[model samples]
Target: MGSFLGFSALFYFLLAINMGNLMVSFSQEGLCSAPPILTSADSSDQPRYWKVTNPTLSPAHLQDLPGFTRSVYKRDHALISPESHMFGPLPYWTNTLGAYLITPAMGSHFVMYLAKMQENSKSGIPPRDVERFIFVVHGAVLLTDISGVTHSLNVDSYAYLPPNSTHSLNCDTSSTLIVIEKRYNYLESHIPDLIVSSTDKQPLVVTPGEGYEYRDLLSASLAHDFNIYIMDYKPGQFLNVKEVHYNQHGVLILEGQGIYRLGDSWYPVQAGDAIWMAPFVPQWYAALGTSRTRYLLYKDGNRNPL
Candidate 1:
């Protein structure tokens, strides 16, 4: 019994030491804190999502760190894990599920947040001042638009709400959602209509390039200043050339792993990671993992030179 107890104690001690080392490694990789307690929203038995409470640092202040640039945010470190409190006032959020604020790391045209909502939670903008999109990453949500039309959105769901449109979002179960808002910079004479669709339902269109396919969620013609696309790249695929564009992009990696080239350096990216590129920055991507790599990308377009 004494020998067994000794071994057990030693085993736990080693485990603790290994956990400490792992945390140190993550910290070195620029995570603001320890590994977060995350719950999969797909699981039926477990809680659908995790809530971040009383963060110590603000989301905007995270940009002040040395590694992040004005035009690129590699991850939502502080907002996802909720170790720091850098979020400013959030007048639009009122729910039991907490919200993690994300300051626009790439550009000033949008306000973004990751929200965890509980069953029966009532939240949303009524007659918004800006155009916005609500994307359901996990679980489901019921969205009601201005005309009292309701739509049920499941995972991979995308909905665009036009400016001055009244909308209400409610979920019957716990869910995770990303809300992005931007003021429309009119490039044409007419206002764009609301677009709603699931990425799974959208047909993949082969692009002119090799090893990639894209699905347009919000195209340039449908929106005033931006286009949203789901891009899929098979394993070992890569861009033909490093390219630069006058338009900027906001990208969120949804699945698999890859190396993203921005400017002169290449950075490793994976699921849940995000990137922001300024106008004319050289960029490229190559799939590195065994599985297919996919991401949701946003590019501002259709506007004259400011």
Candidate 2:
């Protein structure tokens, strides 16, 4: 009996010790849970902000970007052949258009052009079927729609068009216009070609040499799926409004000043500013600077609208 009792006491002591240890462990788990493991992946997912100290400097650690290649280097009027071991030849000035350092050789999903409107033309270029985003880089233009309603656009003004919308431009003064044409997909509604009258119309007169314009200097494809253009604007100009389809867009203000209306918010935009917009967001702009407002615009896809 004595031996059995001793054995039972030993078992109870062991059980109590184990129960106390379990309680301690449970309390510790509640009070001192292991900290979450920090990792590089966590940091990478966090938002990053970069401020421009020097606009001329290339962005750091940018080589990982898609289709990134070294820009062609030019010296005083001479094109230097790249070192054999390095990336191919740098871009030559003649190969560049407007402010773009390089343009895609073949077909681009989007095509950008810089054109000047003839002074005082009662009827400027009529609207066509293409999806167009126009930024009035300089001077003034009156945009008239099919209904004959006219909206005046000046420097820094922008306009976006949905497919098949009819519009026209009337240059009160010789004006510089930056035009962007985006290709649409087969699923999109068809945009008919622009129709214009062949007859001459009364042209507005302005000082010929006083009108000048420049476009986005750095046009590029980002992420192999989107086309990007940077537009610079002078103050007192306006950006037009249009509906967009199949594409979302963002604007990053790199320099100067402007006012941009995205949705119901009227945001005063200046250098180092950014505006994110989705499709069909009614947005427009007005330049507020004495000089120019410069910003980057990006869009996706290369196909034309159906």
Candidate 3:
């Protein structure tokens, strides 16, 4: 009887040890499942979609513009004057999720923090004065227009809204959307033109391709603040010899890899990279590997004489 009791106790002890080891292994695996975050240094050093070949002209030229002068343009272009002037980081809000506002000091620009909607909530966003270009960064959303036009968008999908256009968004699943607002007056001498789909039924979808394909989201003559475009580049394709005539443009890489030539230098670019080019600079790019390259293009300043 004593031997049997001892044997039983040993068996229980071994079982408990095994269970503990299993728990520890499961915990470690769970921790590893989360995605990795990029460090600030890594982001700064990452390659961009456009390389600066010309040592003389680059997006850095905008820094040479006087702050006071830029401020004046900000006031003239934006509907709501920003509380601060220096353009580093903007204010943000948090509720169930995080949201950051990127309000530029000049050229009627503001990007809204991504928002989250409750399961039963009927509306995703409140009515606002500024026109918005909504880009889905994470998850999914169902956008419904006042006329009952419904759009289901996934990550990287976007929608353009004119001023006073009534709409609501619904997130059956969790989502994060970036809303870029144009603050310039449409009645002004230079009203930024909104790029509309040639077909009213569907939003123009930019798929993976070889050559760069762009549809103007907004024109310079229409809005003095900025011009927006949706551009796509297919695998092994590129923009070989193109010159940006007017306005400093910024490229936000949304997908894939490519090599950008800004003058004499070649730079490798991947997803999430951003490159800014000054006016009159000649530049081009080639898609890398088997992946197609895609990006959002923005140009700010006055119309250039072509």
Candidate 4:
């Protein structure tokens, strides 16, 4: 009886510890989105808060946990890169697609993954009430839509699936895809169908401000609630203005190196890095290395103010 009781106690103790850690993982709510600090002073340690309906859905693993709601995620250490099934049995994952979940930093409103697909493998996204965007990094993948139209996508290719759109992926070679899924927030009546071949298309050189140029992937005609772009900056170039707005952003550094000003602190960023900036946080970026800096950027827009 004594030995049995001891074992039970040990089990309960470990369970308690696990539960405590889980709570800590979400204790700060979502990736730190504290109010923007107007001054140029470094506010790296400012209190961060992210609002989410379900905190428990966020990643609780120690390494995946972002200390604040705002984070500068480096590929080497700041982010979590788990193999497929590392997050447990997802509904549609297979060995062919190794998905690294990265949206835990943004909270429950969306999910993001850097997925690697092997050759000759297939995956499906059944009809659902969510919007999805897949951006090809390297190699090619065949995408088949609900209407039976199929096409091949190579590097810099991107497809946007509207809510309830059915699609399946068939890869011809080993490839990397940035998969971004988010609940549809209805604001406009029309959503344009998009299958953008960014590599073949010429980028519009738009200067939203000075010292930077934006390569817009989707134009305003598409009626997407969010905007996506590849921001390009020459060496020694930067955004001269500090911006504070209601739109939240998800960014992936695609190439070169730079430093980003989030809130009041500037952090070094490089290719393969990702960042989540909550709404209203002051932000800016500057190119550093000799090569041009490029980043895939996402920002929520065209929605009614909450």
Candidate 5:
């Protein structure tokens, strides 16, 4: 009887610890959004949260455990390498959810996250007051809009969600997504309509000077307070100039390799690397290697500089 009671006590103790961790973890959420994993299976810390939505859902380790998990390193706002990203509790989401997150806390006016979702994963149906932009990097995602309209998005597809709109996302296959969110001046702009489109379908514009090629995923007019760009570079091309401007940017390297000059230093960057720049930080990029380099970039647009 004594031995049995001891075993029972141990079981309850561990269960209590796990439950406590779960409550604290769900308070925040996504990846430290894709640093190479530093810890191996044998040496990993015991998972603090377990995926347990229902009997039908398979289990996975919830990696972002509140304070226990965060960006792999202290992020340098002027420039963040691919290795440093914010990891937090992603509550109300399920099934192999992983994202490298960039939030306002990191000193940007906007939030961006690269979400890696498995089949059966979804973004919870909640009406966030902020506007949202989602770019599909791979796989398929179904977006349920504020008006209950459902849109299907495939590779290179994107969606712009207006402020105060209720929506949710469902992925039927393995997928990767970049979700950018921010507050908008509805009073000034009158809330832009939701836009659903594909990047590949947009006309590519060659910029002045060095002829950098890109497609504006959003309009350049006041109707949009921000813009998303998929800029492409050939192996030997470079940015037209060292851009120093009022507009800040969050950039995710989509393909190939390049050297990025941010602030006063240059960092070698490649696919899956995420970089965030604050207003007035000098920045430039030059593609390297034998292939083209592409990146998804976000910049605040059309708003008064005040």
Candidate 6:
């Protein structure tokens, strides 16, 4: 019994030392604090999808190469992950929150946040002057538009709030939302009214390839200055067509695994990865693995080049 106890004590001593070393390594990789508590529910025994991604466990690299031009904000166009407590509650969000503020250095024209809210919880109150486009990724929500009409926003449901308009977003169930916000560039034309719709109700417009599909959340019009949409690609190669254009984009990979080429680098991106693309930086994507890949995309629209 004495020998057994001694051996057990020695084993734990070694284990503690190893854990300390592991924690130090994580801190060196830019962790603001200790690693997340690993419970049996989220352990290796569980499937990868069930496990949460910790950026400290899998650090993202910087993409500011010296070869790129200095025209943009250093062009740090790279994959963003849920790092540390950076995925904390959003301001004005009551009850439960773990919204990832996924805005990259794409200038002041646009920003986005990915959130998973629970019942009774509410989305952050939008600034009165900011135009917002909210897309429901999963579950549903009750959005009371500025005119006081409550709309049931279910899966794939989206709402576009014009500038200076107010709305209330309360959960119908545990829901995931992609909120894209931008400053509306006003023109002499009439301002668009509130738009609320879902993807299933909209027609699928095939683009470029047979497997590629698109769902525009909002229509093209002079009254609107920005647009949001979803692009679905089946399992295959679709990265051959690299595009370099003047329109910057904020992208969220909604589902499936894929390789996304942004600027001069290629990143292995999966579901929930947020990406920022600067104007004229080459961008493309390819759906990999066995499932279909879909991404919520945003871009400035209906404005003439100055």
lDDT of each: 0.67, 0.47, 0.52, 0.65, 0.72, 0.71
**Runs with alpha carbons beyond 4 Å of true place in candidate 1:** 1-90, 96-106, 126-128
lDDT of 2 at 194: 26
Of the candidates shown, which would achieve the greatest lDDT relative to the real structure? 5
Which runs of model 5 end up more than 4 angstroms from their true locations? 1-89, 125-127
lDDT (Cα, 0-100) at 163 in candidate 4: 81
lDDT score at residue 288, model 6, on the 0-100 scale: 94
lDDT of 4 at 218: 63
Give the Å error, residue 239, model 6. 4.3
Best by TM-score: 6
Residue 106 alpha-carbon offset, candidate 4, angstroms:
3.5
TM per candidate: 0.69, 0.34, 0.48, 0.68, 0.72, 0.72
Please, what are the lDDT tens digits per residue for candidate 1 over residues 108-159? 3565566777777767573345788878777888888889999999878989
Better of 4 and 6 by lDDT: 6
Name the regions of candidate 6 deviating beyond 4 angstroms: 1-76, 83-85, 96-100, 104-108, 208-211
Q: Write the residue-wise lDDT of candidate 3 on 175-199 in tens digits.
A: 5555556554455454333332321
RMSD of each: 9.3, 21.5, 14.3, 15.4, 14.5, 9.2
The order by descending TM-score is 6, 5, 1, 4, 3, 2
Off by over 4 Å in 4: 1-90, 99-101, 199-202
Better of 1 and 5 by lDDT: 5
